[model samples]
Target: MQYGAQRVSDINLSQVRKMFEQASPTAINLALGEPDFDTPKHIIDALKNALDEGYTHYSQNKGEVKLRETIVDKLKKDNNINTTADNVILTVGASEALYSTVNALIDPKDDVLIPDPGFLSYREVVKIAGANPVALKTSAENGFNTTLDDVENTVTENTKAMIINSPANPTGSVMPKDEIKAIAEFADENDIIIISDEIYEKIIYDKKHYSFQAYTDNAVTINGFSKAYAMTGLRVGYLSACSEIIDEVLKVHQYNVACIDTATQIAATEALTGPQQCVSDMTSEFRKRRDLVVDSLYDMGVECIRPDGAFYVFFKQDNPDEFIQKALKEDVVLVNGNAFGEMGEGYIRLSYAQSYENLQTAMERLAKIA
Candidate 1:
């Protein structure tokens, strides 16, 4: 008997995982983009302290009061977005925040503009919500920057929201400030809701992150500790919006996970309020890795756009599918661009989150494949 919902069935299998089942145990995995660093000791200590103080119970449905307050200060100070604790809802991760936002904002057949070659989760979340995902095709020629013209031309009457990821995934390019300003203006005029996924904001290189929420009250800003603090295991993230949006999203957030764990919340709070040296050190290392990967790739005669932010390098080569298959034969893992979206075809994304030594080894493996 066919019992499951069609919407769930409609979601495609992950491209990032296509060869995962077949991958050799010894493969040098450059496919996943998680930071290789450990969570700082201070953050861990905060979690321990919270647990010792009997913080195991459920927090407010929105999240812990202290965490929300920290997030409010963070938004104002780091992102230049003025918001209050009432506007933020802590979630399991940015994944949950994005999903809850999509669920709260979209109905079946509603169109949501998501960047092609964007984060793997974006399309899946929209599809699972029974919403139509309209691909905002970005290109390598333009440094993969999503332009205002791109969004303006693609909007349909059915369009309700647009997802913008600076330091975008699969490309590793940050949107220029002008593009962000233009898109913000267009969004304002068109009444389109903006979902700015700034999870990588803290990992940027040589550029300041311009949060769309800074430009419009209609924006929902989603961020988490997974990337910045090496706290992926903690599973804490959050979203900030005007009260109306927060209220609606909290209804879904409340039912989906109710609240994040008390200890995790405390750790996340420390991640924000503690000395930020860990973040600086992690970014400095990531920058070194990025340079090593780019320089090494060039030396190997492979062409790639030097990423402005995040810990990935995205580039294209001839016969990428065959190249990917052959690379796997050598036990070096790389994600095909098509795995991200159509606009991503003929390209590949490799994470530089590993050590310079491991990356050099992987680059050597890539040389043989090329």
Candidate 2:
């Protein structure tokens, strides 16, 4: 009579969203990964026009063809991925893409290597697929960089895949090209499938994103419109790999949502091909916020590492739980880094998604605890 699947019981909501829900009404949230910007008017306009033009119906089961084509072109131009529209499957968001692809590729008891202090969704999805989630430990001492040695030690006959996030959530550490090459080389030698999550690719500061797809035919590149285009609510994201792999993922994607909303697909097409200045403007502002928060951490004398990309700052705490409690008292919402993984125990993740003014106020409150 007990109906809930054991996997559903194990997977909790993301700590970022949980913390936001728990915060006092007056709290300035520096926890969630959501960008605090409104979706650009052009994208919204495209959606409205799409609706007026009669795009309210369901699209192809794999997704809207035009949107998938745009994704193919974007992948070719921006990420150096050479793939056709047939290989791209649009999904609800990167969240859905990740879940579906993991399900498609992993068998029960297979080990999927994930970075400790990586994105919140990686482990849970692997668990949902009935795989053993293995952690690849990364440290602030090395810029939180994932190296070949760390990956090598973790690989084994049971290793089936690895979920890599550049401009990672929580930590905001961008994996470097050399490190990526090493990973690519290793995965090739061992036949490990690499799932590259490049959701934060466009928000990086002064660094070009190098996709693992560029280095391996076996890699799956997952990205979305939410982070870069400020279209989070639209729920547009896609997964790209070889046609063979995409064929399998499409089975799962098709049955789940069947298809993305037609108008949203049109909006996503506009996001990829439209004027790109908005993305530049947003990332420029994020760079400023990144600098502002990192500088504030230094000013407060907290031991912190400057996150290279994305909009988070990672600060070490001897007791992250106690530190989080203290920060809550200051009315500054913060997430214990342990929410990321066990290796994240001594740290806390502070996202800079708020405005310069709000971040300044949050910093002022956090400084009281410092």
Candidate 3:
């Protein structure tokens, strides 16, 4: 079958994502990486207030002035990086930010370096943008942190960018300051764009999250209110890059969806500037679940990285595909790590986004299978 573009072959992760949506008793999804919390009442109220005030209209393609300013303030206060509002581009969510950036940077033949056990979206986004996705292997033995040695082996002249996620998805590993600095320096020297997805920045267990933007001048910092503020439905995420890169991405943005909703922009501003207690509370709860899962996995003789951040556990099994098949029969569904990329083989990514009771029950079910 002929398609308009080769990239059309790209598919969403819906095959595994739909495991829970289908409501199979044989499926207990710890697959999707979504915040289980309800959107804070105050943030919801802010949207209602915007509706009452007739804030509905086509917003600026780059987003509203106030929201951009709020995002700028957030970057300075939280990440300790000074960024101007003009350098930021608001997209539907981090997903769109990632797509837009990859599209803007790559030609049909370009290659993008990605972490092995990364967010499932990275490769799909790269392929959809008409680029080749190259997996740079990072292992559980190495704490799933990307080393300069691993990346140096992967980079070539055709490499256009590198996608980095810390407080990373699936693995839940947070790269330290020294490693981030080394990667940033490498990107700078190689003239490759670094797309840092910091969406899970706030869900850390013990250590503070580090933004790659803090270490380099050549990286794009991708963030959103979805994970941190429990505003997943709002679909408001923004990217902070150099003005040159931001301009090119906005060109792609204007052609494909035009812009985000005005009311969501207003609500997002309130999320950044208003009370932050919700984020703190959510992080505390996630930590508790992380502890429970980590302890349980250890007891089961399943080796997992001691995740410093994020609500996930990337645990190894003797044979991941076989174990996942058996686990589904045991009525505790999880994503086979190989679904993310080839380097993700022999692993299973279990999201701790469910309640403690559900996690405990799921663990017990897996134990029975063991």
Model 2: runs farther than 4 Å from truth?
Answer: none
Model 1, span 42-156: residue lDDT tens: 9999999999999999999989899999999999998889999988999999999999999998898789999998998999999998889999998888989899878988899
lDDT of 3: 0.85
lDDT of 3 at 28: 64
lDDT scores in order: 0.89, 0.89, 0.85
lDDT ranking of the models = 1, 2, 3
Candidate 3 per-residue lDDT over residues 18-58, each given as its tens digit: 65664465556787788889999889999999999999999
Using alpha carbons, what is the TM-score of model 3? 0.95
lDDT winner between candidates 2 and 3: 2
In model 2, state the lDDT of residue 75: 86
Could you estimate the TM-score for every candidate?
0.98, 0.98, 0.95
lDDT tens readout by residue for model 2, 4-28? 8987777777888888888999988
Best of the two (1, 3) by TM-score: 1
